[model samples]
Target: MRGLLTVCSAVLVTVLTVAGPVPAAKAAEPGGGDIGEALRHVPGLTVVDEAPAPDGYRFFRLTFTQPADHRDPDAGTFEQRFTLLHKDFSAPTVAYTSGYNVSAAPNRSEPTRIVGGNQLSMEYRYFTPSRPRQENWADQLTIWQAAADEHRAVQAFRALYPGKWLATGGSKGGMTATYFRRFFPHDVDGTIPYVAPNDVIDEIDSYNRFLSRVGDDPGCRTALKAIQRDTLKRRDEFGGLATADAAKKGYTFTTVGSLDKSLEIAVIDAYFAFWQYQKQSDCATVPKAGAPAAEVYAWFEKVESLTTYADQALAPYVPYYYQAAVQLGSPEAYDGYLRDLLRYPGADVPESFVPKSIERPPFDHFAMPDIDFWVRTQGRRLLFVYGSNDPWGAEPFRLGPGSRDSYRYFVPGGNHGANVAQLPPDEAAAATATIRRWAGLPPAGPEVTARSAPAGFPDFDADPIMTARPRL
Candidate 1:
C-alpha cells in the first residue's frame, strides 16, 4: 500500500513559438494486428514494460485506469497494475486475481501453465503501484470494489483474447476469484480458487474449531499448544530476543502495539500457522515442554517470523488487514487456552491489528453473505481446491442444491498450499480434465503435461513467499 508518481510538464519559449504547434500523438486503437499493438490501444490501459518469458510466450507489465468507486466515475481514478503472459490470441486466458500486490515482476500461474493459456496477473487495488493517491482507504477498498476493478481490466482485454477464459488465485486471491465471479459471472468461463476461505463474519468460529483438532497426531497438537504456553509463560525472554532482532533489523512494532505484545500475538498464532504450513510428520520437530528456552524460541521463530508484526512487515499488508476488518472477516483468535498466560489479552485479535491511523468501519455483515449466497445458488463452472488440515478450509464454500457445473476437492493431508495438482492421481486427473473442459479444450490423457511456473511465480499459499520477499 505505498508509492508511485505520475508527472507532466510543458515548455514554451519565444523562439520555439515560430513553429506550428503539433497535436499530441493519438493513442493506439485496438485493431486487427499484433497483441502488443492492440494492447497499447486499449483505452485507459498502458503497457509499462515487456519482459522475457518462456518460449512461445510474451510478457508485458501493464496498468489500467480504474475508478476509486465503481459506482461513481466522478469518485476519481487510479492506475491498477497487472502483468500479461501471452502465448497466442487463440489460446485460452487465465485472469489471475492477486489478493494483494503481485510479484515485482511478471510470472505464470499454475493454472496458466496447466491451461497453456495467456495469463493476466492483476495486483489488487490499494496495493503499491495500484494504490490510489486519495487517502480514503476505508471507502475505496472493498471486496466488491476490487471485483469491479478485475471485471473492468478483464473486459478491457477481452477483445484481444476471444477464446475461453478462466479466473484463478490462491488463498486470499482465491477469495478474490470467487468474489469476482459473484460480481461478474460472465467475465470468466470458470474459476479455480485454491485454499480460499469463505469467512462471512469478522470472527468465524470455524477457524478456532478447526485449529483445535486439525491434524491426526494429538501429540503434535499437544506439543504446539505447549510451545504456545511456554512462549507466553516466558514472553519476556522470547520478547527480549525478538526485541533485539527488531532493533538490529530496524523493525518497528507500533502497528501492533510493542514488541512484547507482538511476541504474545505470535505465540497465539503459532498453532494456526504450524498446522497451516507444516505436515503432521513435521510435528516431531516441535520442541516438547521443558526444552531449553533457546530451543523453544528457535522453533517458535521458525514457525512464525519474529518480524511478522513489525511495522515494516505489516505496512504493506495494511490494506489486507483493513479488508479483513471491514468486509472479508478473518479468523478469530484461538487464545482461550492461553488466556491465563496472556499479557495483552484482547490486543491479539485480528481487528486489533488494523492500522491505528484509520477509523475501523463497522463490518458489513451482508457483503460476504451475499457473495456466499451467490456462490451456492447461482455460481457455475466453479472449482475449489482446499487443504483438509488448513484452518482456512474449516468452512469451505458449499455448493447449494441449485448450483450446477461446480465442484470442490480437498487434498488428503494437504496444507494451505493445496491445489488441483496436489490432489490424488484420479482427483488430479478429474480436476485437470474439468479445467480443460471448462476452457473449451480437450480432455486430458493419462498424463497431462503442465508447464512449470515461471521463476517469479508465487506459491501464494506459502508464508516464506512473504517473509523472503514482502510485496510492495
Candidate 2:
C-alpha cells in the first residue's frame, strides 16, 4: 500500500457515549443484548478506551487477544488492537481491514461513509500496537496468519453486529482485505481493494516497464528522467549538501549504510514518486540538468524526501519490508536508466531494507501466486479500484472466468489515491451500487464528499508497504 501514515484523521469529536440515551447500567456481561455489553461479551476482546467519533457514530478502541501462531493455540498470545465505529445494530458493518497499524483515532472509510453503517477498523497483525511479545517475525507474520487474525476478530464482532458485512481497504489494507476474503470466503459479503497490487515476487520488474510508458505526455516521462540524470550528475555537490543537511537534522543512515548511499536511492525513488503521487501538471516543476544547485536539490527533495531511505525513517517500516521480502511481493526500483549514474546498483531490491536482527526465511514464492490465482478465478463479490496512472496499479488483480460478481475499476487519471468515488459518474455509481446491493442496502447510495488524510500524513510518501528500497 502507498501511504502508511495516512490513517483516518477525523478530528476527535469528544462525546460521552454512543449517540443515544445511556441505558440503565446492567452488569457489563455478554448475552445482555445491549450493544455496549455485546462488545464486552466477545471472547478475547477488551475495551481499551472510547474515542471521539463522527456525529451519530460511537467509536470504541478495542483489543482482541489472538494466538501468535494460529496453528498452535498453546504457542502464545498477542493483543491485536482495533476500533469499532458503531452506528446501529441493524445496519450493515464494513470491516475496514488495514494493511498496517490501525490508528487510535476514528476515521470513516469510503464504504463506511457511503453506506452509513458501522465499521470495524482493524490493525494488521505484527504491526505496531499489535505485535507479539516474543519476536518471531519469520514464523508468526505469514499472510495466512494475518488473515486468521482478521477472521477471528470478525467472527467475534459478528456476534454483536449481526447485520450484513462488507470488507474494504486502500493500498496495503486493500491487499489485506483481499487475503481475508481469499482465506475465509464467506467472512464478508463483498470486498473492495483500492489501488492494491498483486506482485508475484519480492523483486518484480513490472514497475520498470510501467514507468517507461506511464503518462500521457512523452515529455513528462523525459522530464522525470532528466531530473534523475541531473541529480546523479551532481551527486558530489548534492551529496555534500544532503550530508550536512542530515547532520543538522540529526538523521542517521546506518540502516541503509551511509548518507551518500541514501542519496543515491533517493534520487532513484524521485522517478517513482513522480508517477506514484504527482500529476501531469506537476511536471512543469521538473528541474533541468543545468538548473541551480539549490533549485535542483530542492526539486528532488520535494518530489521525494531526502530522508526517505534513512534508517530513522525506515525503522517504523521494517515489518513491511520483512513481509515484502518474505511473502508480499514488492516493486523493484526503476533503476535501469540510472545504472550508469548510480553508485549503488543493487540497493533497490526489497531484501536490502529489512533489518539484520529479523531473520527472513526464503520468499514463499507460491504464496502470492496462489493468492493471485485464487482471487482471479474463484473470488466472489470482489470490487477492485485503481488509479490508472499509479504504478501499483500495474499489477492489479485480474478477474477470471470462475470469478463471480467481481469488478475492477480504474479512475481515469487516478494515482495511489484512487477510489470508487473518484471513478467516472457511471463507473462510480455502478461500483457503489454493487457494494450497496451486496451489503443489503438500498440501491441509491448517499452522496459523500471524498475525505482527505488529516494534515501531516500525506498519502504518497508515507506509504508503508512499497516505500523506496533502502541502500545496503
Candidate 3:
C-alpha cells in the first residue's frame, strides 16, 4: 500500500519541478469587466444579494440558469445557486463546486482557507433550487451536463476574478471538481479533490476487501462481522425495533418497498459506514459476541441507521442514484461474508435501490475508462487526498511515477475527511507550501485562516441527510 510519504511535502515539490513545464495561462480576453457589470449582460445570470462576510470580506449570492441538457440548450433551463466570496478582483480565486444541494448561505472552502483568496461555491445541477421546475431525469442528470454547467460559471467568473483560479470539493463534491477539470481542462488553473474516488464498476469489489481488514486489531474485525451475522440471524426482532424507531423518527422506507428490506440494507451498510466515518478508536463500540439482539441493533443504529435509506432522506439524492445507474457506477454491498445470514441476498444490487419513477439507462462502461485515461495521462496541476482506510480510496486515480505537476496524498490511518490541513505539522507545511507556490502566494503561515462555516452546516460524515455511500 502507498504510504503517507506519497503525498508528503518534499515529494510534491519535487513532482512539481520534474513534471513538464507548468501549463501557460490562457490569454486574457478583451474587454475586462468588473463582476457586477459582467453579470448584468450574461444570459441566465443575476446577482440577487451581496453582504458582508467574515474576515472583513464580502460575498454575493447569484442564480445561474443553465440548460437542463447541454446538448440541447434550447430544450429548457434550471437555476443553479452559487456564492462568491470576494477578496479582490486581482486576487486568486477558488471555485468550490458542491455535489449536492447548494446551501443558501455563504461559506468558505478548504482551498480558499489555505490560499486566502476569493471563492465561488456553485451548487450541483438537478439538486434543490437548482432542479428544473419540470424534472427530466433521462438526459438531464449526466455528469457531462453538470460539468458544462460549471464551465459556464467559470467562463462568466473569469472575466471578473482575472487572477489565478483553482477548483475543489470533498467526496462527491471532490469527484465533481475533478470531472469539471476533465471536461473543461482550461476552466481553472488547478484542482484539489479531497477523498474522491474513480469507481469503475457497478459493484466495486475493492470495498469488500477493505472491510475484511480495516482497524488495527483482528478482534474488532471479528466482532463487527459477528455483529452483522447476529443482526441478520435475529432480523425479525431487530426489524421490529427498527420499524418502531423509524415511526418515532417519522421515516419511511417506501423507496425500498418494505421495512424488513430497509432493516436488512441498514445491517449491510453498517460494516462499511463504521470504517468510512469512525476512527480506529471507535472500533471499541462494536458489540461483542453473544450481545443482546437489541444491543446489537442499537449499535447498528448508532453506526449506520435504517433512517438513512428512508424516503425523505433519499429524496434529494434521487439524481445521484440516477447518475450512478447510468454513468457514475456505485459499490455493491459486500455480502459475501454474511451471505448465509442475509434474508435478501440481492438487496445490494445497484438498481434495486433506485426508485421506480426514474429509469435506469444503460451504463456507459467506457465513461470511467475514458475519464481515468484523461486524469492519469493528461491531468496536470492536480492534487488528490485520500484516507488510508477509506474504502473509497481503494479505487483512487493511479498517479504514475512519471506523472508531472500532479500528486496524491494519503493520510496515514486517515478516514474520508483527510486533507492537507489535517496532516501532521511537517507534512501539512510541505503540502501547503506546494499549494502556496501554485497559487502564486508567499510562504504559508498564520495569515491563512479558514472562514467560519455557515450555521447549520451539515456534517457529511455523520449526518444521515449527507450520507450517501458512493462506490467511488
**Model 3 TM-score?**
0.86
How does each model score on TM-score?
A: 0.89, 0.87, 0.86
Worst 10 residues of 1 by lDDT: 1-10
lDDT of 1 by residue, 1-472 (tens): 0011001001111212232112222333332357777776677888988887667777898888888876565668888888888888878999986587766454666677677788888889987878777767767788767877887777777777888999998888899999888777788999999888887555446888788788898888888888788777777777778878898989987778788877778777778888787787888899877788778778866777756788887877778778777877777778998899887887765566677778877877667766676677678999999989888898888898757899999989998777777788888888898899989998866345343354455443443333231211
The local distance difference test score of each candidate is 0.75, 0.75, 0.72
Per-residue CA lDDT of model 2 for 1-472, tens digit only, reads 2121111111111211112211222232232345666677677778888867656667899888888877665568889888888878778899986577776666667887667788898888877778888868877888877877777777777767777899988778888899888777888999988888888554565777887889899998898888788878888888888888888878888877888888888888888777777777888999877889888878877678766777777876777788888888777888888888887898966676776777889887667766777776678999999988898888889898879999999989888777877788888888888888898977674364245533432332244333333211
- Give the worst 10-residue stretch by lDDT in candidate 3: 15-24
What TM value does model 2 have? 0.87
- Deviation of model 1 at 250, angstroms: 0.6
lDDT of 2: 0.75
Q: Please state the error at residue 418 of candidate 1 in Å.
A: 0.2
lDDT accuracy of residue 407 in candidate 1: 95
> Ten-residue segment with the worst summed lDDT in candidate 2?
4-13
Per-residue accuracy of model 3 over 65-135 as CA lDDT, tens digit each: 77776666456777889878776667788988658866545466768778878888888887787888777
Please give the lDDT score for candidate 1.
Answer: 0.75
Screening candidate 3 with a backbone cut-off below 3 angstroms (N, C-alpha, C), the clashing residue pairs are none
